[model samples]
Target: MAILKQYKKSDGTTAWFYKLYMGKDPITGKERRTTRRGFKTKKEACLDLARLQLEIESKGLNNNSVRTYRELYNLWMSQHTLNIRNTTEQRVRNYFTNQILPSF
Candidate 1:
């Protein structure tokens, strides 16, 4: 869904804006939103919305798969260990799990 809006700017200039709902994030299942402003005409906003919708339909709502950070970390670790040595892999994995995955 998208809505066009008209508002007064801080400089007292009228502008056109649009808020486009980009659907839920696959990883978090939260609603995604995007807004663009400063369009001089509604036609520009409409055209941009059309382009965005096409891209969303072609690609996806969100690329992530609703996996938790731990799940994603394990998935990435599996791929990362494919060509690496066992010792180095363990060190790297430890670093990520301790210093990085927790943040996510």
Candidate 2:
């Protein structure tokens, strides 16, 4: 579901904003949220929300989001390592290689 808000921008123009619930994150199993800001009209926001709903229904909560767990894990690790410390990243890499990858 999505909720709409009418907010005044820094430039003093009123715009529509919406927060959409995009199901769970594949790696975290936590709620994933997507927000869009600065729509010119409420109707436009409504239309976009409708489109998202149709996509969710036609595909699934994940919306054909990813194909496999291994592929997903690889993609996740690639992005996750960029912001973390080197030692922590290496430890995670080792754990995945030694303990996790074998199970897959």
Candidate 3:
């Protein structure tokens, strides 16, 4: 869904803005939203919002993959272990392998 609103700019002029719901994050389960401002008129905001909706409808939000817990864990560990010490990294790997992977 999209919502349109008008607000006074710093120059004391009325401008239009829009708020759009993009959907949820697959990994975090959080609602995703985007806000665009500084449109000159409500029609301009509505046009931009319609274009964005068309793009999203055509592109489908880019969430086509279904990843398992192990895949997600490996992906996380690849980036997360970069700055950590080898011992700490090993501890984290062990914790995930022993305590986390089994439950999932």
Candidate with best lDDT: 3
lDDT over C-alpha atoms for residue 75 of model 1: 81
Among residues 3 or more apart in sequence or in different chains, the pairs in candidate 2 whose N, CA or C atoms overlap within 3 Å are: none
Least lDDT summed over 10 consecutive residues: which range in candidate 1? 61-70
CA lDDT scores, all candidates in order: 0.86, 0.86, 0.90
Better of 2 and 3 by TM-score: 3
Candidate 3 or 2, higher lDDT: 3
Candidate 3 residue-wise lDDT, 9-104, digit = tens: 888999999999999877678888999999998899999999999988887666545379998898889999988999999999999999999999
CA lDDT of 91 in candidate 3?
98
- Work out the TM-score per prediction: 0.56, 0.54, 0.56
Predicted structure 1: clash tally: 0
Model 1 Cα lDDT, one tens digit per residue, 20-91? 989888878899999989987888888888998899899898665746888877887888899899999989
- TM-score: model 1 vs. ground truth: 0.56
Q: 57, model 3: CA deviation in Å?
A: 0.9
Over all chains combined, what TM-score does candidate 3 have?
Answer: 0.56
